[model samples]
Target: MRRPGSGTRRLAGARVPVRVRGRGRDHGSAAVEYLGFLPLLLLVALAGVQLGLAAYAAQQAGTAARAAARTAAQRERADGAEQAGRAAVSAWVAQRSTIGGTGGCPGDAVTVTVTVTIPSVFPGVDAFGPVHRSATMPCDESN
Candidate 1:
């Protein structure tokens, strides 16, 4: 016979109910809920990463533009402005970037424009567009 208030009940020739400590009907519910919410969490994380990538791409574009403009401002280095721009950014960004502008010391200033495609964290998704940045530098007449 089980003691009173022991959290067990027994009927005639029937199984008894045993109560486990620190366990209830809601046991493992949190895990189930977490599983249900896992997708959303991952999506948020990916979105944050994608945002960071886009920002980095924009920054890289600006850097590339400045570098190209600086190089183009010098008549002697004008021919290598595009190369300098590509070399200013990360290889991955450089591979997906385009640099163009007016150089030649013909004008008082040299302008360079750089475009970098924003990378995606998810494959087959290209919703994020390219980032464009432009920079201008005074031409060096001597060079």
Candidate 2:
């Protein structure tokens, strides 16, 4: 108990200590993480796409080579071989894909080549030069 006009300890007279609690500061954490991981993510995605494209080009090349060989054996005409190879590649791949045929029938193996434009998703990389695929098959005995 305190008397009047005397400064005594009271409930209101005691200083209330303030302890400030706040959430941890995260300034652009997500952005920083994304920036750090962006290159890896892009590399993986690009590699997957490139591998798929390469497989597809290889399949097209095989198909074209087989078809050209068959055509060379049957028709024994160079034009027919070229046409067959082009047809086979065009049926499965884009028109931009290239198809070339060489060689002859009767002891000659027909060669078919397929080429495609590699996508340049990566910076400062040439994706168009080494994109060629080739396959060769022996002509049948008919021609």
**TM-score of model 2 vs. true structure:** 0.57
Residue by residue across 32-54, what tens digits does model 1's lDDT show?
Answer: 99999999999999999999999
Q: How much lDDT does candidate 2 score? A: 0.64
Error of 1 at 51 (Å): 0.1
Clashes of 1: 0
Clashes of each: 0, 0
Poorest stretch of ten by lDDT in candidate 1: 2-11
Best by lDDT: 1
- Give the candidate number with the greatest TM-score: 1
* Clash pairs detected, candidate 2: none
- Cα deviation in Å at residue 33, candidate 1? 0.8
The positional error of residue 114 in candidate 1, measured at the CA in angstroms, is 0.4
- lDDT at 13, model 1: 75
